[model samples]
Target: LLTVIVTAAGLVSSELRSGSAALTLAKPISRAAFVVGKLSAYLLHLLAATVLGTALCVGATAILFGAAPLGDLLQAVALWLVYVLLLTCFIVLLSCTLRSQLGVAALGIATFIALSALSLLQPLAQTPVGMADVVTAAMAGTAFSATWPLVTSAALALVLLATALLVFQRKEI
Candidate 1:
């Protein structure tokens, strides 16, 4: 979670602070294109890290125990990836709006904590906020359905990304 927050928080604000965003925008690319490009790069890096980390974790689990449930592990990891992607989109939006990376990171962390607390409510248990519960259930090899949370999370991520692009477009370099 911290990884997603930190990486996304720096994606745009750091560039703006360092005066690189202005230089990059001076090129022929559209502002939307530049933002999308940065997001794509971050997603690629996140994918690689998630894959490698999952592989190492699985290997270690298998070695420590007699066997590891690959299906359960993969399911949990998939749900986790979806959740983290949503979080990354949120932090990216914050990064696009905020001038300071630290401010973005702080707000990102606060939002995470707030949502986590909200997820404790029964009414929000099926929402994206409850994704942690779904991931936990999957990891525990329990019967848990995450269809609503996954769908909502993906939809929210798309919305957040679009909003971020719009915000960046209106922002002054």
Candidate 2:
């Protein structure tokens, strides 16, 4: 979240706040391309960081524990990637509307927590049943069900990005 906020939203917000946006626009770059390019760069950075962080964590765990949980690690990595992508698009969208980095960061955090809580509703709804029931249900939830969070995150991210692009296209530099 911090990675996406600082890299994507922070950079753009700072550029806009410092009046460099006008200078950059004075060149021939279209606003769409500029926003997309900035987002792409941040995503690339995020991808590299995620891969490197995962490698180091797995490597360290293997060295200390003799074996690493590759399956669980991969699952976690997939979820985290979806989360980061979703948040990155969200920050970009928020940054366009909110001039303050602090405001964007605060809203991003709130958005993440809200979305996460919503996602956990499925498990919580079944909680009154018992722990065993929850675990069993989760296990039996099917592959798609198990990966529902990732799918939802991806969908939301796409929507947010599309909206951001539309807003950015009409926004004055």
Candidate 3:
């Protein structure tokens, strides 16, 4: 993701801002194909990072922590991949909308902050109820609070990615 922002946003935006879209057009490529090629390159770049990161994480778990139960480990990893796809979709959508490094950085930070807040909301809300009260109540009824935030986040990401694809296809640049 960082590499893409550095290479694509910085490098690509420089070309767009300087009216170099014509240079790309001179290659006898359709505008849609050109932009799609750029997006696909960045997509591949992110895929490399994610694949390497996952491998390193699993390797570290085995080397440093020792191999544990494979079932739970795989389950955790599968869940993580779902969230990662959600994130990648969001980043790609934002890249289409802003096409600027700074804009992408700001949006990424804001999205992370918002998601973190949502994830932490239960504890934050229960603070006023006292820890003991929360624990007692949680033990009595349910251990989990609202899961709507996660559902919403996933839905929003899918919607945004779909919208971005449409917008990017029609975009003149």
RMSD of each: 1.0, 5.5, 7.7
Regarding TM-score, does 1 or 2 come out ahead? 1
Give the per-residue lDDT digits (tens) of candidate 3, residues 1-173.
24433444433344455667668767878755655566667666766776787688779888999985555444444444445445555665666666576776567657655654554456443222122223233334535332443454467656866776676666667
Query: What would you estimate as the lDDT of candidate 2?
Result: 0.67
For model 1, name the residue pairs that clash. none
Please report the TM-score between candidate 3 and the true structure: 0.58
Q: After superposition, how far is residue 88 of candidate 3 from its true place, in Å?
A: 2.8
Please report, as a residue range, the 10-residue window in candidate 1 with the lowest summed lDDT: 1-10
lDDT of 1 at 155: 95
Candidate 1, superposed: residue stretches over 4 Å from native: none
Q: 1-173 in candidate 2: lDDT tens per residue?
A: 55466656564676778888789888999777777888888888878988999899889988999896577567656655666776788898988766778888888877666654654555533222122222234334423333444455567778888888888777766
Please report the candidate that would top lDDT against the real structure: 1
Q: Which digits, one per residue and each the tens of the lDDT, describe model 1 over residues 50-123?
A: 89999999889888886878999999999999999899999989999999999999999999999889988978
Which residue segments of model 3 deviate by more than 4 Å? 1-15, 18-22, 25-40, 122-155
Ranking by lDDT: 1, 2, 3
Cα lDDT of candidate 1 equals 0.91
Per-candidate TM-scores read 0.96, 0.80, 0.58
Full ranking by TM-score: 1, 2, 3
Backbone clashes in model 3, listed as residue pairs: none
